[model samples]
Target: MNEISSILAICGACISFYIGAGFATMQEVVQYEASYGSRFLIVILVAAAIYLYTNISFATNGNRLKLNRGGDIYGVYCGVFGEKIGKCAAMFFDYFSAFFCFMSFVVMCGGANSTLTQQWGAPFGVGAVTLTVLVVVTVVFGLQGIVNALSKIGPIIIAMILLVSVVTSVTGWGNFTGNLTKIDQGTYADVMQQVGGGNPLASGASYGGFVILWFAAFLSELGAKNKLKDVNIGMLLSAIFIFFAAGVCCVALIGHIDATAAADIPALVLAEQISPVVAVAFAIIICAGIYTSATPLLWTAVRKLADEGTVKYKAITVLAGAVGCGIACFVPYKELINVLYGLNGYLGFVLVFAMVAYDLRTKMSLKHGVENETAGIDR
Candidate 1:
């Protein structure tokens, strides 16, 4: 019973970490899935398969290798080439991932501002500053602090997202097929141009790729601390839940394609269509989702620079929060999501290839070792 609870906790944490501001807002779904029209289901399924594979690989490898730092997983993945090349690759990934994580933090702040302004007419600064302070304070408490908070908050937020998305999709089913046909006929061509342009396959791959980058270091660290069986099961569950929720959300968004395509926060817009009270409730839930994601991303970036609990770590945390808030206040949230996530997702494909290579090499070597051991025993 305790073991089952632990696995569920891990699953919830994984889902929560991946949810983030863009996802909870439906901005990510708009760009990656819903914009593709009738083919959105296929795109999400493709991404979900990739998510499961990458999560399992990172977690299991992290447990087996037990590296000193989470970032070291890159070194292991690249070491299949040569020691010198591996070190270079590791250094590159470490720095690039740190920058990426920080930029993602900036996106979270922007999302917070957008959500608040759209829902309650709050000042942009109010949301940005409020989210930044909360994130920085939580990050200061470090990894365990983050895990504890996310484990509890993650499940609740995911439940709320599921409920809202499922209800919206069901209620709006009358509009769904017609909206899909309109989308296929290019009714919203201009909106599609703004959100995305890639084919379903490329978009799906890119979606999975960027998400792999997000989980690489974090899951590796998690695997190092937990049992392999538990980590594997947890990640598998997370992958299933994420894609299922995304698919449902995509259906809901498609049913209201006109409003969703134009709105900054489509999920909130859909909820508002249901009731102002539900919209208000979902706004708070979205804020919580943003908080859950921002905490780990900030921690990942800062941890790369300084050890937790050190004075340097705390100082960098505050400074990052400030800079991120400043950036979020100026940049449009949609622009940030469209540009950063799309570009970085392609870059993440490179890491995905590296991870595949590492996995293959490891399996072959293990097979060879087993063969040699059997021969010796027979002799």
Candidate 2:
């Protein structure tokens, strides 16, 4: 691809991957961000900053390291501690990340089922099966196919979210400040249960943590394939778009905090307040977001198990889809998101620290090398 197209593709893929079922549905936003009242901006800003740093680091370093597999990123980061520790840490991250990815796929399926049932009164199986089939088929085409599909679908889904959120915010402008006042007054204590035990900073950290886990393998792989400059630009754009979209959605949710706090899909609830037509359209957008997110998550997990396009890989993909669909159909969507995201997010924090250490070590080593070269030249 040309430079512009390449940049857009990377930007789209990263944003789409981040804007998964929880994000599109606004459940994550309500719980993790908006629940903090006026401090929501601070929480999201913290998240966006982490996203900017980790994404650039992963993509650019992946290009430089040229690792054989994306998951090997853990080894590189953990190797900072020592050889034995690196091996253990790498293996733990591989298994844990794979498990997290699969569970995340299940969350997507649950989101699809919930959206369809709530919006259209469709049978639960229809949404789960539909999403499963789409994800499985796309994954079978491999990473290039996944990226191509997401690069197009991602921007469309993001636009729809922004449109819905902005409209909701404008129409409910009068209620926005009033709601923030109530939150600040502690009137909605029962309504706004904090994600990180009432600490916005911890909540923000966890939010960044889970996201790092989600992108670690996926971005690394993308970086290994694309130019560093393109990856850097694309990831920067992704961070900006994600933070802005999330901020708008957070404001929208805050405007309708009373109703949104009680609902499973806050964004859909807001859209419905606008009109049934908007609600239906946003429902479809939610499913699309889920698809884009699910495809990469499932691919990341399965890619760890088998090489792309192999018979074994195809078999595993199909099996994983089937299993995920079955579990999602039975589980409560909101509860699943809370348990999985909350726990995995904290684990992601550990990975973030490792990444920082790795970055510092690499920069120091480069500096040392430059000094050695200067000494030789002087001699």
lDDT per residue (tens digit) for residues 69-122 in model 2: 777777777776676777778778878999999999999999999999999999
Pairs that collide, model 1 = none
lDDT score for candidate 1 against the true structure: 0.85
Which candidate's lDDT is highest?
2
Superposition error at 329 for model 1 (Å): 0.7
| Best TM-score among the predictions, by candidate number | 2
lDDT of 1 by residue, 1-379 (tens): 3778778878888888999998899989988999888888778877887888888988888888775567777777776566677677877887888889999999999999999999999987789899999999999998778887888888788788888988889888999999999888878877653333648878888888877767888899889888888878988888888888899899999988888887889999889888999999999999999998998999989989998899999999999999999999999998898888888887877888788887887788787873121110101
Candidate 1 Cα misplacement greater than 4 A, ranges: 193-196, 370-379
TM-score of 2: 0.95
